[model samples]
Target: MNAATPLPTASARDTTAFLLDVLIPTAAKGPLMRRPRVEALAERLNLDRRAVTRMQKLEEKYPGGPLLLRLPIRKQAVVLLPEHLHAVLAGSPEPFSPASSEKRGALAHFQPRNVLISTGGERTARRALQEQALDTNSPVHRLASSFLPVVYEEADALLASIGDGDGATTDVLDWDLFITSWLRIIRRVIFGDGARDDNQLTDMLARLRKDANWSALKPQRRKTRDEFLRRVQSRINTAAPGSLASVMRGISEQDPAAPRDQVPQWLFAFDTSGTSAFRALALLSAHDEAAKKAREEIDADTTGGRNLPFLRATVLETVRLWPNTPMILRQTTTEVTWDNGTMPAKCGLLIFAPYFHRDGRRLPQADTFDPGIWLQDDVVDVGAREDWGLVPFSAGPASCPGRHLVLLLTSALLARLLQDTSFTLEGASRLSPSRPLPGSLDNFSLRFSPRPR
Candidate 1:
C-alpha cells in the first residue's frame, strides 16, 4: 500500500480514552507544569503508564500504524513506528513544521518572535542568531569559564541555606526550596549577577505562562506582557560580562532577530531543566551504582568547571526516563506521504516520548537507568540518523538550541551538589533499581535529605 492507504482510525471510545488518559492530563499539568495538585494526581494514577499501555494495545491492533485520532476540530496522526517519527522530525520546517498551530498559540503569549514559533527565512535568521549566542555546537559553551563560577556560587548558597548550622548529617529539601535556588542560578547565568534576586521578574513571567497554558484561548495580557518585556530588556541592557545576555549582546545583530524576545523561552526552558536536575539527584539517591559512578566523575574533574560528561549523561537519562515535554507536537505544513498513509495539511502529529523511551520491546534497558547509552557517539548524534527513538531533547534540525548549554549548567549543578554530600531519596518508593521505575516521577512531591558521604 502507498501513502494513501486507509489507515487505522481510532474508535470513538479509544479516542475519548486517549484524550482523558493522555492529552487532558498533560494539558492540565500546564505548559509551565506549575499545577502541583494535578501532578500529584497524575502520579498516583500512574497516568503515563496508562497512556503507554493504550498506545501499546493500538500498536498491536494495527502494527506499524499511522493511527488517525479524531480530534474535535481537526484530525491528528500518531506516529507508532520509529521510522515514521524519524521521517517527520527530519523533514521539519517544510513538509513537517515544528511551529505547529498549537505551539504558536502557546509561545505567542511570552515569546512570539522566538525561533520555535517562526518559519521560513525568519526562522533561519533567528535560529542562527540563537545558536551563535548559545554556542549550540559546543558541549561546553564559549562562556563556560564565566558561567561555571556562578553555578558553583549559587550551588554553595543553596547548600548553605539548606544545611543545619550544627553540621548535622542530613538536610531536608523539596521542590520549593530547590527551585528558589535554581532560579537564582538561572537569573545570574542568563541575565547577570545583578539579576540574582529578581523574584518579581520571574513571578511576572510565571503569571504570563499560566495564561499561556490556555494558549490562544486565553486573551493576551498585553499590560503584563509589556511590563515583563520591559524588565527583560532592562536586564539585557546590563550585559554583565559572563552572562548569556552579554554574549547575546556581543553577537552581531541580524535583521528580525530580537534577542530580548527569546529570553522568555530560555527562562521557561531552564525551569524544566531545573526540575530535571532535581530528578537526576533523586535517581542518584535511589541507585547506588549510578550514584557511585557520578561521584567518581565528580572527583576526577579537578578543573572546578564541573562540566563532567557522566553528569550530563545522568541528566539525559533522567530526561529519557521521564521527559518534561511528554508529547512533542508537529503540524504538517503541506500534505505529507507516510508509509501507512497520507496526512492532510495542518494535521497535528504526536510523538509521545514516554512510550518510546520506556518501550521494553525495543530497548533492553528501557525501564532501567543507564546513562551510558548517551555516552556513545551513535546515540548522542542520533538526530542525523535513524534513532533508537530516544528523543529527550527532540532530534533533528528543530532540536533545542540550548541543549548543550542547559546540559552544561544542569550537570555542573548536579556535580556540585554531589561533591561533598550524600543524598537519600525521601518517599520515592518506586525509584529503586531493582524494579522498573515508575512512569511518572512527581517532582513536586519529591523530597531528598542530604548527608555527609
Candidate 2:
C-alpha cells in the first residue's frame, strides 16, 4: 500500500487557491452545509463572510464533498465528497481494504476487536459464527418471533411506568430503557432459561446499561465481562437436554474454539440490536408525520396481518436518515485515482453515510422525511443502490451480516409500538437541536406523549 502524497512546496497557497476557486463558490446555496473546517479554510483564504457561512453550513451537512482538509498527520485528512466515499467503500478490496486498521478505529468506541471490527482470521471466524446465527432459516429468527410477546410485555411495562403520559414530560432516553429490556427478551429467547438465569451476564449487562459509554470503561468492563463469559461457558459445558444454551454448547463442543469468543458474540448481539432499535424508535417519535404515514401504510397493507411493506420502508428510511454506524472508514491498499484526486495507498478514508443521505443528487428533496422513496417502483433506477448513496446497513463484502435480522427485529418492534400506542409530540414543542448528550452519532432523545385509549 502507498502512503499520502507530501504537501507541495507551495502547499499553503495551493490549499488557499482550492478553497477560493473550488469550495467557496460551489458551496454557496447548496442543498447541504459544509464542516467548520471548510469555513476556517475560507477565512484563511480571505473569503467573504456570506460565502464562508454558506460554505460552512454545506460542509456540516454534506461533509467531505465540497472540500478536503489536509491534516498535519501524514496521509490523513477528511474527504468531504460523495464520489470519494463511493471509491473507498464500493471499490475493490485490493485497492481499498474495508478491514484496514484505520477503518477499525472508527468502530473502536464499540466492538474494539470483534470480527466486524477486525480483519484476517478473527474477522473470518466472527463472520462465520454471525452468519450461522443470522441465517434466514436459523433458529434464532424463530426464537425472536416466539419472543415477540415477551418484547411486547416489556414495552407495556415501560408504558405502564410512564402512566398514560398524564402531561408528564419524560426524556426519550427512557425509551432506551425499553430497548434494553427487549434486548434481554431476545437474550432469553435465544439463549434459553439457563443463559437468561445467569446472574453474571445480567449483572454485566446492567453495568453496561448504567454506564452508557461502556467502551471507555474497557479495563474494568472487560474483566467483568470475561468473568461472566467464563461462567456462561461453564454452564454451557454442563448443559442438559434441548435448550438455546445447549445449541451454543453444542457448537462449542463441535468446535472447541468457539468458547474463546462467545462473549464478544453476546456483546455484539446485545449492543447492536438494542442501540439500533432504540435509535429507530427515537427517530420515529421525532418524525411524527413520517410515523403517522408509516402507521397508516402498515394498517392498509397488513390489515393488521403481518410484514407490511410500509412498515419495512419506515424502518429502512429511519436507518437511512440516522444510521447507527453513520461513518465507515477504509485504508487504501493501492494508489487509486478517484473523484478527481489520486489517493496514495495507506491513506485513511472516512465515508460518512449520514451526510450522504442528505445529498440531493441521491434522493429527491433528500432532507425531507419521506419513507415512500424506498417504495418507489424505480428506486434502483433512481440510483438508490448506486455506490454509497443508500447504505444504511453498509455495502460490499464486509457489509453488516445481520442486515436481515436487524430489519426483522426493528420492524417487529415498530409494528408493535404503532399497534399499541397513539403518539404525539409533547408540550406542542419541538426539541432543541443543540443538546449534546446524544452526541454527534445520532440525536435520539425526543419527548412524546402517549394518548390513553
Candidate 3:
C-alpha cells in the first residue's frame, strides 16, 4: 500500500493564534456558568463564529488531514474530517482516551475519579456505577416517573412566580429567573427535596470549576474541593427517597466506585444543561416552526409525560447551534494511525465541536434552526459503520452518561413553559428562521416575554 499522507503541522503563529483566540476564550467563558461577563463578551465579539471560520480556513488549506499543532512540549492533532471526528470519539478508552491531560487536570479539581478520567479496571467499575445510577442504556431514565413530577412542579412554580394573569400582561424571564428555579429542580432531583435550597453545594462546585477553567495552570483549591466533597457526601448519605442519590443506594459501598466523587461531575454537567435549557427556550421563542412543532408535541400528549421528542430535538439543536462543550479533547493511550499519518501515544486530539456542528461548508442545515436532523438516527455509536457530522454530546463510550436524564428534565421543562404560555425573544440575540443564526448566543442575556394566550 502507498504510505499514508503526512500530518500537516501548523506554523508557530497558527499555534499561538489557536491558543490565544480559540482556547483561551472558551476557558475564560468558565467551566461552569460563573463568568457571565465573559459570556457577554464572547457573544458581543461573535467569538464562536470567528473560531469556526478559522478552523474552516485551516481545514481548506490542509484538506483531508488532521492539522498538527506544534506546542512547546508536546504536539496535538486538530481533526478536520467528520469521519475522523466520529472515529476518534467512538474509539474512546482504547487507542483514543477521554482522559486527556487537560481533562484530568480540569476535572481533578472536583471529581478526581470521574469515569471520563479513569482507566483500566477502575474505569470499568466506576462506569458501571454511573450507568446504573443514571440509567444510561435507556432513552428515558428508570426514575422518570419520580423525576418528571419534580420538573413539572418546579416549572409550575416558576410560571406562577413570573405572573399568573389572563395572559395579557407580559412578564420578562431572564437567566437569573430561569436558572434559579432550574437549579432548585436539579438539586431536588439529584439530592432530594431537603437539599432543594442547597445553593452552597452548587456554589462550592462553581468555585472548583472556575479554577478548573485554568486547567493545570491554576493551583488546586484543595480546601474548597475537600469541602465540596464533604457536602456531596452529606447529600449522598441522606439518600432521600425518589432522588438520584436514592437510586445510587443500590450500589455497594465496597465497589471502589468513588460515588461521592462522581456527584460533582453531575452537578457540573447539569449546570451546562441549564444553559442549554435556557437557550432552547430562546430558540423556541424565536423560531416559529420549531415552536409550533414543540407545542404540537406538547398538546398531542395528554399524560404530561416526558416523551417530547421534538422538544428534546430542539434542545439538541440548541447545543448544536451553540455547543456548551465547544472543545472536545482526547489523548491517545497508544499510537493512533490516521488515514493521513500516525500520531504518537499521549498526543492530544482536538475536535472543535462548533466547527463541525456549524460549518456551513459541510452542513447545509448548519446556520439555521433545524431540530429535524436529530429526529433521524444520525448519532454515531461505538463500532458502528455510520459517521456523525454533529456531536452535541461527545459520542461513543465517553458520551455524557446523564444524557437521557438531562434531556428528560430539559424537554419536560420546555413542555411546561410552552404549554400554557407563549414567549417572544426580547434581546439582540433574537433568531429568525429565514436567516442564518448568530454563532454566539448570550444565554445570560437571553430574555423572553410571556404573552397572552
Candidate 4:
C-alpha cells in the first residue's frame, strides 16, 4: 500500500448508472449497500451525481444496519437537522454516550480488542486514562514542547519545496500531506520514539483514508493494527524515558490495570487529534478569504509576531466548515421517541454536524466563510454561550477534552506560516470535490508562496 498506488477508478457515467439504478433501491430497502453508498445517498439527497459518485469511491465503507435488507446496520434515517445534533450532544451520558459510538466502526473493524473501542467497563477505563493524559490542566507542556518543533519543521519543509519565498502557487492538497506528516510527528512525540518507526500505523491510516469501502479493507487494516500493537508492546518492554509509551509502561509496572488501559489511550489520542488537524487545515485552505483575514488579524495582534486570537478564529472557522468527524453515529440505548419518529433500542442514529452547520436558521449567512462569527467584542471568545452554531470540537461533558490542545496546535502552526509567508490557490478555485487527495477527504489545493521581507 504505497502512496503511489492508484485507487480503483470508475467513469462518472458508470457510477451514476450504478447508483440511480442499483444502489439506491438496495439502500432504500434498508440493506447494507456495498462500496457505493455515497452514490445511493447522492440520489436520495439530489446532490451532484458526479460529485457524489466520486465521494462514494473515496469514502471508507461500513455496515449500515441490523438486517441485510429490512433494517440497516447504520442508516441515514436519523436526524440530520441541527436541533437533533444539539439534543443528542447536550443529552450525553443519559440517553447516549458520545465517545462510545463516535469511532465504533473504526474500532470494531480494525482494533476490536483495543480499549477505547471496547464496550461497558473497559470503555470507561480506557476513556479515564485518556482524560487523565489529555486533561487541560495536566502537564501538556511536554507534549506541546515535543510537538511544536515538528510543526515548524513540517512548515519549513513545505516552504522549502516551493523554492520561491512568496507569490508562488502550491497545491493546498499537498499542504494537507504536510499537515498529515506533522500530525504523525506529533503522534511520535506523544507515543514515544518507537512510534516514529511504526510504519504499520501509518499504512493503516493511509489505506483507511483512500478506501471508502470499510469492509473491503478490514482484513488488511486488522493485520496492520495487530502489527502496531506488537510494536507498542515491544516499546512497553523497553520502557524508554520522556515519552507516552514510557509513561504507559511505567503505569503498567506500578498499577496492574495499566497495560490493558494504555493502548486505547494512545489510539484515541492519535486518531482524533490527527484527524482534527487534517480537517482543520482542509477547511482553512478552502476558504482563502478567511485564511487571509486570519493572517491579517494575526499580523495586527502579534505586533509583527504571533497572535493567539487570529489563530483561534482560524481553527474555529475551519472546524465549523469541516468538522473532523462530520457525523456522529449512535445506537439507541433504549427505545427513544422524538419529534421525527420513534426509534427502537439498538436502532442506528447519525448526527450530521456538517449539514447542521450549514442550516441558515442556526448561523447567519451559514454558507459563507466568516470567522468573525466566532469572535466577540473583537476578541476570540470561543467559550462564550452564543457560539452554539460552532461545534467542531463538539460540546457538553463528552465534548472533546483535547479541544483546547487542538486549538493551540492549529493556531501555532497557522501563526508561524502567516508570519513568515503569504500564499494563494493554484489554478483550482477550491479543492476538487471529485478526486480529493486520499480519495475521500475533500480539501483545497492552494499554491502557497512565502512572503519576502
Give the TM-scores of the predictions, in the order they appear: 0.94, 0.67, 0.93, 0.68
lDDT per residue as tens, model 1, 1-453? 586665678888878887887788778888654688888888789888888887787788778777888668887978888888877788887888889888888888877888988989888878887898888988789989888888899888778766685543347888888999899989988988889999999999999899889988999898989899888888888869878888566443344777878778888899889989999999989888988988888888886744577888888888998898888888888777666667788888899888888888878888889988887652243232255788888887888888888888998899888999888888656797888888888899888877677
**lDDT tens per residue, model 3, 1-453:** 124544678888887877777777877887544588988888788888888888887887778767889788976888988898888878887888888999898899988888878988888888888898898878778888888888899888788766555442236787888898899998999988898899999888887888888788889989988888878887888868878888666555456787877777888888889999998988888777777888888889765666677888788888888888888889889776776777778889999889888888777888898787777563312122234468887788887788777778898899988888898788534577777788888888888777654
What is the Cα-based lDDT of residue 239 in candidate 2?
Answer: 48
- The candidate with the higher TM-score, 1 or 3, is 1
Model 2, residue 321: C-alpha shift (Å): 2.0
User: Between the candidate structures 3 and 4, which one is better when assessed by TM-score?
Assistant: 3
Candidate 1: segments with Cα more than 4 A from true spot: 2-6, 166-170, 250-254, 377-387
Q: Sort by lDDT, best first: what order?
A: 1, 3, 2, 4
Q: Give me the overall lDDT of model 2.
A: 0.50
The per-candidate count of clashes, in order, stands at: 0, 18, 1, 21
Candidates in order have lDDT scores of: 0.82, 0.50, 0.81, 0.49
Model 4 weakest 10-residue run by lDDT: 60-69
Q: Residue 78 of candidate 2: its Cα lDDT?
A: 43
RMSD (Å) of each candidate, 1 decimal: 2.3, 8.6, 2.8, 10.5
The TM-score of predicted model 2 comes to 0.67
Q: Candidate 1 overall Cα lDDT vs. reference?
A: 0.82
User: On residues 1-453, what C-alpha lDDT tens digit does candidate 4 reach at each position?
Assistant: 343332232344644553454344333322111223453353345443233332333222311111111222432233433455566667664465543443454444444444434456655665566566555433233456656666566656656655443643453435455545565565566565556556565555445433323433334455655555565567566644555455565465334234633554444445445444544544455566666676676667533222366657766765665455545655557655554234455555555455455554445555455667777776665442324435776665456656666666667766666666655435433343232222123332333434432
lDDT of 4 at 193: 53
